[model samples]
Target chain A: EFIRKLWEGLLVQSKPPLTSHFPFPAQIPPDLVDKLERLALVDFRTKQGLECLEKAIRFADQLHVVDTTGIEPMDSVLEDRALYLREDTAVDGGCAEELLKLSRKTVEEYFVVPPGNIPLPKKEERSSMLKHSEL
Target chain B: MLGLTLKEVSLAFREGRISPTELCRKCLNRIKKTQHLNAYITVTDELSLTQAQESERRLQRGVPKGPLDGVPFAVKDNFCTKNVRTTCASRMLKDYVPPFNATVVQKLLDQGAVLMGKTNMDEFAMGAGSTDGAFGPVKNPWSYTEPYRTLAGPEADWVIAGGSSGGSAAAVASLTSYLALGSDTGGSTRNPGALCGVVAFKPTYGLLSRHGLIPLVNSMDVPGILTRSAGDASVVLSVLQGVDVRDSTTVPAPSSHAELPEEFDVRNLCVGIPKEYHALGLSPDTRAQWSRVADLFEAAGARVEQVSLPHTQHSIVCYHVLCHAEVASNMARFDGVEYGHRSSMDSSTEAMYATTRHEGFNDVVRGRVLSGNYFLLKQNYQHYFVKAQKVRRLICDDFRRVFASGVDVLLTPTTLTDAARYGDFTQEDNRTRSAQEDVFTQPANMSGLPAVSVPTALSSRGLPIGLQLMGKALDDHRLLAVAQWMERQVGFPSIGVHDDYRQCSDTSSTVQTSA
Candidate 1:
């Protein structure tokens, strides 16, 4: 008899109330999706990208109904313990060659990237531009 | 030998029954034979043999490093290994080799553990199913049928090895390696561990150093251990858990919890069965196994009670928000600057950056990055990111309140069901499937508690089903002790090697070889 009751109790406890699904924004605007693409630095301008974003947003919307008024936002799980600190020291240097070896394009000791649109002021104006920015 | 635990194999090495070189050769042979499983991304044949030879020399001298000495193990490709490619199963890093080893990998190698290979995983460890890698999808060993072995193509129906640590779980399950290192952000390790019939352990956050782990979520990611038994998991954890200057989040002192109690008594244990774990979509077999295990604890003179963690249902939603927000920030490093795949579309720097990311990342990774940036937008930051963090506190408080109420641990199903068919699993988008698959396992990640998935029984369909036990923060040893006890009682049958391959392994004489 106790076993039967235990089984029944197990069955009863297994069924918790389903998470309430509150209605969320039906669709994220395309402009907002474009902005997200720019910020993330990924091309999400396709149909598939928009669909993926919409699904993720809808899934995350479930958290909005949670009431967290008095609770402080948790940044790290180890907030209770003090993080370990060591004396400020320089170590693991002299690996510029090794670091440079990993890059596909390198000029001398520096990584090579495509030229930027910002035209460097003529060599004569470079010092003046720096001075102006500092001022 | 492949069927044995790390301790068992280590004992054999001490007894001089088998040498480390022989065991490594057998593992390499087995890995070769089971290539169809798509478990490994890169096999370090030369490195493994060389390491094995060194271990053999040490064994001959009658001086061993530790329990892991001469044991063969695999690592998930996400952890950087010096001079070896660590792809994280993404094209962005397909040909990229690291200049330094991850602290965890270095620690294991320092103990003389042989590195068999690097296993496959979801690209950048982003998805729930291991089907999203650039190389190919990993098929579950349990679901590999006779006909499919000969007839199956990439599109053929097969069971999924759960991800993002699917390859590690499959490797351990398939007996190709004694143990494998996996990383768990939410349920990446335990989800696959349950499906693959192995012990998957996620230590308390900050308990294990995460240096060079290739962060998925910096705040929640922990180096996970996957082995055939709880005892082996304990042995591996003892070697890897410590403070490292490379990762500042590590706890200051070495964890004494790595040492298991000499004798564990369940009579003194008070196990809490969190009622909220009995959530929707939990299969009948999973629920039955959960209850049976609870009954086993009660029968053994332990107090079993129902506890309510009201914030459990909100964890998945909260995790999505935080995970996406962090991913957006962390993934910003891969802009074709120094390492990783660089695009040749160098018309302009901005064009090059966008093109490189678009070509390098898959749809799922790009989707998360996009949604992550959306959540972090100035206007929506408070609504999504800040709100989720506050809800995260509530989730953490739920575990705290339960533990404070004299509960030694909480027992829940590791996954809602057994391993699913690739055809059926892919029916839903990766994001939807991950949310559903990770429901039970993510809460512990949220709370920063120690959790282990112990395979308890086979479902009616002949697939593995595991139950999860979560202990309070830093209570890893006791938690694993209980899991070890449960493992003994259950005696879950692990996957066996093929008879033909077993015969071949037995007859092959050990050869002294150098790479």
Candidate 2:
């Protein structure tokens, strides 16, 4: 719950970041803007806000605040709060997917695609006897 | 000689001087002769012939679609065309074909520009030179000397064309097509145009629609053109510019039929010289040429002043980080899945996807994608991506502040050194080389301001030299008009060496140092 609140607060609707603390701003290198937007959560109040949230997330991740291994069983919301304060991260907008991914079911969805497989075509004996020209 | 601007090509057809069929034939012939320049990845000769026949029928009916109606043109390979292979110059999409045309391609076809073929580019438009492309490097038509063998080998004697729009620039330079479409994230369009002695224009962001374009950086990837002249660029822009529902980024501004101020007066123009552009790395010969050109502008009554773009130093680092992030995202769509080339996924989905990408993409693109992923890993995104974005804002402010302070346009060299040998940019030291190459061009892109690189004169080695003119966002017409006027004043020689291949025999350094 603490991590959730922290994610919420960090991503809460806010103005576009004028500072470099976020992933994207009104002006950044085209490449960097591209980077921030890609990782950025689109759920922010504005496009700019989403970019900011991305930057904040990136900042925390770089500081080793985000545990990539997923080994710890600590509450996600609590983890987020620790990251928010400890990393001093600020995001102009919130990312819905990131928050959702911290939930139980969504984690499975992130790892799965269509599970069914296509069966190989089976040829009938009559069809197999057909010549190339006849076929 | 089919000496026709894209606009003139249509005019000629209307005047009965040439039929669209004949024009297509001529263009086909040129491509056949000059394809050695590696200007194209695929030549849809059959498709082009069919389109030309259809255009002839339309001409007979006296119903013209638009100015570009029946004008032969090519697009950089990154754009999707219904069934044509759109590689983005990487093996990842070597056999991939999109089901739909990019919004820009649709607009062009609707305006009646004939599709000649898809041109080559740096893989995913990532490199300064076209060397990083999967097909092969594009050769400069102007840099040709003798025997016309392509630098790629003895059978293909074309010179190194400037890139990543090297193919587009070379095509237009050699009359392979009337106009060619290119995408500019930085100086891609202008740099090649300058090196190839053509007019390349990157309009203000949102001026030209970017829908369906394979995204480089969403904000910076503006569709641009390489043509023979600024007026022709205007003609092509007229056909391509407008808000489209598909591309949400395009501005709602209607096409501006703004007239070129009848007599261009450089007297009222304020040209800013950023101190950062004149740093120590600039060659003496280049500096001399720059000074001479500046003097020419002054003699023509233009007011020139030195100014500082303080945040200029961070442009390269910021652009690289940002570009990598975008690459990481844009490329995610190419994971051998539903849309693109799929490899046998005997392994897990992620593993299969990784293997496909690893096998399919070239080294340069893969390196950039990995770097982008690393940069955005939760922790790095904040410090690198966010900080880069902030720096980007400062870059934009630098341009805004300069223009607001009475500077109508900013002038700088397009690249510090003329086209280096193709191998110079691929080594580990590429970061330094790339930085020097992008010095004058990145700021304009970072700010979303319009910039044009016009060929001013030849370098000491007979390579072309260009001066960039940057304008306030959306003020593209003025920059082009001024460029057109300057083009008239200092008519630079066309690097027409492909037709006369005896100029490049000697590989002496003096060739680069001579006037």
Candidate 3:
């Protein structure tokens, strides 16, 4: 009887299905994919990458049925408690040399990177570079 | 001695039955013998020996630090260890070493716990199965076989150690280490703990300091303790839990310590079995064990009641949205500029960032970043990210409402089924597997409640199955007490390297009478 109640609860829901109200795109459009690539600084031209994104979007569509009316968005789990703050003070600093040692390419004290405006490596070239690095 | 629990080993150390150095050597030797498990990313042989010698000297002086003194423990690779390579099982930080130890690691070291080494994990704790790691998948010690030892090729098939703390779980199960630290973000620790047959505890969110833990989802990630017993977990938790200025999220330590009572009075307890947990895809064995345990609670005078957490169905979806959003923001710091893998391409800073991320991260990590960015996009923020956050409130409220109704702790299955083969697990994408496996465990993370997965029974396949007990925020002591009672009642047989080769033909007779 207990198990039956559980099954019944699962089948007979209090809320209506909201799938029609919010029609999520079946596939992530190419332009949006390009935008995501730019925003995340990742290349998602492959089929697998696009599929993962589309699946994620489809999965998230389930939330539309949740009637979150007047619900304040919870940013942290400790929303009920007061977040303590410490007095502003420099606890640890003055280790620029040690910090600089972590980087691969450094010019004196600063990290060295190529100047802006240079184009990205081609797809084939990027793969080859990765392969070479692996070796 | 190698198979003893942390408490037992500590007791042995105090009684002079086993020296810290001898125990450390035994652990190191076991780790070496079980190399095929791929549980460790790096073995701190010299460092561990030196620490063990120091512990021996302290024992000689009768000035041991605490219960954890001289016990060997493993840290997940995601936690920073000064001068030791801290890889999140990613090529990105393959050679990168931190300048300081994680606060949890430092606390354990201060307690005189010998650090065995860093355990392998999912690349950035992103995958449900440990297979996403760059080093290799951590094979379940329960699935070890003679063929696995002889097999030289990578083509050998084996069961998976669930992730992203799969290596820690595997290490504890295999007796390579008595206790290991795993970071749980959306069931990473509990799932592996369930699969690998160990006690995995994820305390309330702010209880343990996450200062040096490589962030997966900052709000949900907590340093997980994986051990052979709940008592061991409590001991480790007592030492590790406290407020840290380094991490503002850390809460002040509770007035009482986290020690578990030898027995709990079930008559005073109300065990809530959330009906929503009886969802589809739950294995027959797991469901039976769930029912059996609920029955046991009732028979033992506890008021085992059927409760409803209506918002449970939407937790996984809500979790994915929030997890990806946080992951996208947290992962932004990994650009090749500071410390980690750098692409040779220096044509432009942007190009370097792009190619470096592409080369450093695996497909699963990149997918999350891209999807996270999409959700965070201005046009989609309100629809996706904000909606998920609102739904997250409902999920948290579900737990709050149930606990408010006088339910001491909620009992649920840690995973839908037992460990799967590597081939079977990889059949689905990382997202799907994670959604299915983490369904029951992630709700606790979403609500910031303390949850512990206790190995309760062996599946018909002879793999261990764990059940989770979740308590209200800051109620870890009672939660652990209940869990320890359940542990004593079950007497679930733990696995060892020697028992791996036994044919699992009969499930009924395989249940051990003693722990």
Candidate 4:
């Protein structure tokens, strides 16, 4: 229903499809669907996102027809090249001091986020979560 | 003074014929003269002059950083430059200023290369025609004489400076800068470089540091260079290399591969022309040019043959899936809390995130982000994302097998045609056009191989036609050496504003020999 509501009027009808309609729909449970879609952005698909997404789905479906049965999932093409790695140690990236200034709320030089998984007393619990930027 | 190549400009700077200040003024003046081209996002006029004067003083003291010292260059908007509003031609970063420079920019500054400004690009480097950026499309500097039946408007005659790095290509073509840095996920650098009649080089993945480059598809993204010739590209490449702790993907420079050789031998080398690249959509002129280039190599004593990578058709589909998924994940960092555009409307933090993203992102970015989330969903993950990645493995293996067969490099057209005119180019919606144009360039990025696009000939109307050369992962030096030889053999006139550049000038002569 979330996607059905969002998909109705969002796509541009002017051009004939460069590709066919996707053969399979996202087969997730209805409840989990909106939750993940929410994480991507609001499900409305305004700003041509719905069209953007529709194209990807159609292309992905086109790719799905080709048999990729035994192929291993590829990751880290660099790891294939035998590249050298820097040792893990703390170094100044100049992010904290500069970035903290942009946050609307902060506490004692640390940027603050709304209450979520972590309890306020334990700073280590928050520190343990990985930063997406680092990845 | 007006039409000198990057090497000639460097020589002039050294000989005291032109001071860095004078050189920068010339660049600024050139940019001013061609404002309709819309090549830059910001022009850094006073700051450029200040930096140029410093370089001039340093040269007077008899200590210069390197060959690039006192040279002026532009950077694609995607690369972050400190305090110099590094917008990726998107509203999200429309007013955001970086606290630090991208590693490549810092490296150039260290070499005393004057920063001219950030050039325009597709929003988040997502589009192919450089026409989709927030600042509007970059116009091709080439004489736009083509009267296409499908094209329209006041700029109808103007060919599109190929995109997402369209600004860089147009800038170098217009003589706004000596060289410009652009990011290539598939063919962003080379496409525009080809369209604008210049040399564009995408280094082997991870060779140049990606620390400050705004992420598009991180796995495929590499910092690329655009300049007047292959030799200038080699000069810029040596400066912008080295590992960074900030970006773990970068490999430490093996000292031997850093510098390109002065000369390369074509004798006894093997070149492959993939049969799959000879698709129906390739124009007759492009097809003939490909064969003529192969003949040139054969005549010069290198072995050239038709090779097959049957999986080529599936690459664009696989590339879209993989590229969209990564764009979704990378763009997640642009929420309202810390940096970038924050929404004014508030309900809860959830509403804030949604509104900010809706307001901040354009249709192209939001679409990919949404689809990425859908692909990564637990139920769809196996069917879409993983399958695409697995196909990527096949693509990688294709290059590996071909290289294993002793074909040192593969040759292909950089784009299907010469610079596309704006009206005809935009008539096809973004995604369709992007897919078709990227077909020839995607394999190199997908496999992490080095690729460079150098002008082979001009179109019937004076626009550039680029031919690409792909090489082994770390053998960038060798690839450039071969490209340099091709450059020497063609003697393709390097283009600029004041010079009388002709359309398809050499094709008349080559057509006689090949036909």
Q: What is residue B338's positional error in candidate 4, in angstroms?
A: 1.0
Runs of candidate 4 with Cα error greater than 4 angstroms are: A1-36, A46-52, A81-84, A93-95, A104-135, B143-156, B257-262, B499-515
Residues B1-515, model 2: lDDT tens digits:
35567766788888878888898999898788775677899998999998888888888799878778888999999888877889888767787767678887888888777899999887888766666677777777765633223333343323356667778887888788888988888778887877777888888877777766888887578887888777788777777777776665666444465344557889888877776676555666566666766667778888877777876766766677777777778877775554454545433444345445655665456555656775677876666676666667666767879989999988777877666654444442333344556767877778777888787877666666778888887788888888887777777775442455333333321121100
Q: What is the TM-score of chain B in candidate 1?
A: 0.94
lDDT of 1 by residue, B230-345 (tens): 88999888888878988889985345554466577899899998777777788998988888888888888888888889898899889999998899899999988799988776
**Over 4 Å off in model 3, which ranges?**
A1-25, A117-135, B145-157, B500-515
**Per-candidate iRMSD:** 7.9, 19.2, 3.7, 11.5
Model 1 chain B: weakest 10-residue lDDT segment is B506-515
TM-score of each: 0.92, 0.75, 0.92, 0.87
Worst 10-residue lDDT window for candidate 2 chain B reads B506-515
lDDT comparison, 1 vs 2, better candidate = 1
What is candidate 3's CA lDDT for residue B85? 94
Among these predictions, the greatest DockQ belongs to 3
Question: Could you give candidate 2's per-residue lDDT for residues A1-135 as a string of tens digits?
Answer: 332332233234322312234344333454554443233211122343334434433432322222223232211111122111123356334645533332222343353332334321122321222212110
Task: Put down candidate 4 lDDT per residue, B321-402, tens digits, no spaces.
Answer: 8898899899989877887777664435655566667667766776677778888888788888899888888888888889
Q: In terms of TM-score, how similar is model 4 to the real structure?
A: 0.87
Q: Which DockQ-derived CAPRI band holds candidate 2?
A: incorrect
Model 3 TM-score, all chains together: 0.92
